[model samples]
Target: MLSSRHLIFMEVARLLSFTKASQTLFISQSAISKHIKSLEYFYKTGLFERHGNHISLTKTGQALYDKLLEASQLQESLHQEIQQLNETFRPPTKLAIGASTTISLYVLPSVLSAYLRQYPNLQINVLNRNSNNIQNALLAHEIDVGIVEGLTQVNTLTYTPFMTDDVLAVCSGKSPLRGRALVVADLPTIPVALRENGSGTLAVIDDELDKRGIPVASLPVLIRLGGTEALKNFVLADTCLAFLPKRAILKELAAGELVEVPIQDLTLQRTFYFIQRKGTESNQLVNTFIQFTKRHYSNRE
Candidate 1:
């Protein structure tokens, strides 16, 4: 358990504003000031130096803040572990997972269903967003785990390679691009449907094209869709080509509603990541689910 003064100091250090920290911690501003003063007096050092309306941590304060953060994390982890131990027979574990639109729509449902069958007591909640938003959520401590495409360079997060997926160029059967091998240069002339910003599929497509000295700005985008289903629907109804995850359009391809076209000089393969914050312990349920997903995909491959 953290002392109230220490917790208040931690919140103020993180927010950098006594008023904001007060509102966040549901304490009065005066109380926040008293706590800060107490901490500063005990250490005989100025924690925060005031400059107009802004406050910044001093060197000593920064060191203390780092120590406080580590202590708070350890306290939380200990509490969670004890709770897990208390409910030995049927532990109630809640996991909040963030995923990109493509993985959430096409890949996660069956995997989650199978996981639930094995651990029926675990409660799972999924938040579907774009890759960037998923990363943001993980950083903000809003989600326990994230599954995203492409590589992320957030130093605080640890990424494990979960699986690889291919993005295929697809169009309606009636479209002219169907039944043809299209080259990279040809993509600029065709009206393409694209996913919105922050989407993993869109990011990979843009990155791959850039590597080949082709700018995404060169492509004439006919439409921008928010979700995978919307993008597939746009391609199915219009004469526009879309780059989509192969898993997303499997049923459409099988039913002849959409046709896959090979793109020359492009192999849009992306590795999906299982991401979690570094130093965070994985609960038994999370560990089991991750293992199951790995085994299931490995057997399929």
Candidate 2:
């Protein structure tokens, strides 16, 4: 059983409202106040500062809240594991995953099918969003694990390399530049499409171009779309080129629907990473899935 005082304090800290915490925990407002008061008396310091209608945690309160938040998460994870172990007969193991657009669309679907075959008892939920949003989801504890193509690191998150993605410039099969190699100087002449800002593809593109004495904004950008599929569609309908993951355009390349445009003296690459909140690697479900993904990609290499 969880300590009532600790649980009540955590709820109040999370919600920043005694009234809301009481509603959430299905207790009386007076009871909530009583528990908080007792905790403050023991700690000998104020945990929350109350205004007319709102409340906020003090520095000491924030530190205690962080610790208690981790403890709550551990408690939930522990209960899940124990239940799984107790009912080996038909254990329900759930794994919720958050993924960026590139990994969710081009990479993980195939991997998940095989994973499910091996652990049919496991239930998996996937949330596909932009790389930045995926990181936010992990930080918010909305998902168990995340896979993203973005290389930006959050200090409180861990990024483990899952696979390498080759990003290539491509155009429709009918484009004049089809199957042609171009010099860096020629990049300025061609009309180009780019992913939306803050995208992993755009990030890598920016990095590579910056190293070559060019800025992405200096390029002849025809359009900027929010996702790979939109950019691919726009490119196929017009005489524009885009940098995309090879995996994303493999079928198109193989079928001759799109052609890779070679850039001399430059190769753009980004790694897809497994992401999790710091200290979450010790979680059983997270550890299992991370190890599985790493082994799968390592064997392919």
Candidate 3:
């Protein structure tokens, strides 16, 4: 178990705000300050440098935080193991997972249902957010795991490949591009319905287009939808063309509501990753679920 001072230090380091830490811990600001002061005095070094409203970690603080993170993980792992042994039936564990919109709708439900059947005592909470928000949730220790696509450069997070999905260029059957093989340059002439700015799908599409020297701004975008389902509905009703995850609109395509047109110069393959903070040890339930996901997806791949 971590000391109260150490826990406070960790929270402060993670959030970089005394007020935010206080709100998260349900403690007063002065109490947070006192805990930090005690921790700094014990270590005989300063942990944070405050400038106006902003605070940054010092070098010594960074080193201490890394060590404390390892220690906390070990302690939690030992506690969980002991709890598991003590409960003959099964120890209850809570696992909070964050996921982007497309994955939450199309992918995670089946996996989570299978996991729950095996580990009946485990309580799983899934938070659906955009890719960037999911990353932020993982950093804040608000979720045990995260699944996202694109923008994978997180030093503190460990990513393992879970699945690969392709983004398809699709339009209503009535659209002019419905049966035509379109090129990347042809995107600018089509009336496009795009996903919102922070969406992983949109980010990947923008990045791929940028690589081909085509700017996203040049596209004739009709409307920006918040989720894949919304975008699919927009395309189904309107003449707007959309770049959507292939898996997300499989039913629509099969039913002939939408037509998938291959893009010549665009390779819009996106990989989903299972993400967790580096140096943290997962509880037994989390470990089991992760193993189950790997086995299930591996066989499919």
Each prediction's TM-score against the native?
Answer: 0.73, 0.74, 0.74
Summarize candidate 3's per-residue lDDT along 1-301 as a digit string, tens digits: 6788998888889889999999978999999999999988988999999999989999999888889977866765776778777866454466789999877987788888887887788788798998889999988777888889978578888887788889988889888777798788787888899999888899899999999988788999889988888889999998878999998988988999999888896889998888888866355555666789878766655
| Clashes per candidate (backbone, < 3 Å) | 0, 0, 0
Candidate 2, residues 1-301, lDDT tens digits: the string is: 4588997888788668988888867999999988888988999999999898999999989998888877867775876678678855454566879987787886678778878998898888898877877788788766889988856699999888788889999999999988688977788788999988768889899998888888898899988998788888898888788898887888989998889888899898888889888877778767887888777756766
Candidate 1 residues 1-301, lDDT tens each?
7898997888788778998898877899998898899999999999999999999999999999989867866665675677667856443456779998877887788888888888787788799998888998888666778889875469998888888888999889999887889899898899999999888888898898999888888999987889888888889999888998998888999999999888877898888898888877454445666788888767767
* Candidate closer to the true structure by TM-score (higher is better), 1 or 3: 3
Measured by TM-score, how close is model 3 to the native structure?
Answer: 0.74
RMSD of each: 5.9, 5.9, 5.1
* Residue pairs of candidate 3 with colliding backbone atoms: none
Evaluate residue 81 in candidate 2 and report its C-alpha lDDT on the 0 to 100 scale: 72
> Which residue pairs in model 1 clash with each other?
none
The TM-score of candidate 1 is 0.73
Evaluate all candidate structures by whole-model CA lDDT and list the values in order. 0.84, 0.83, 0.84
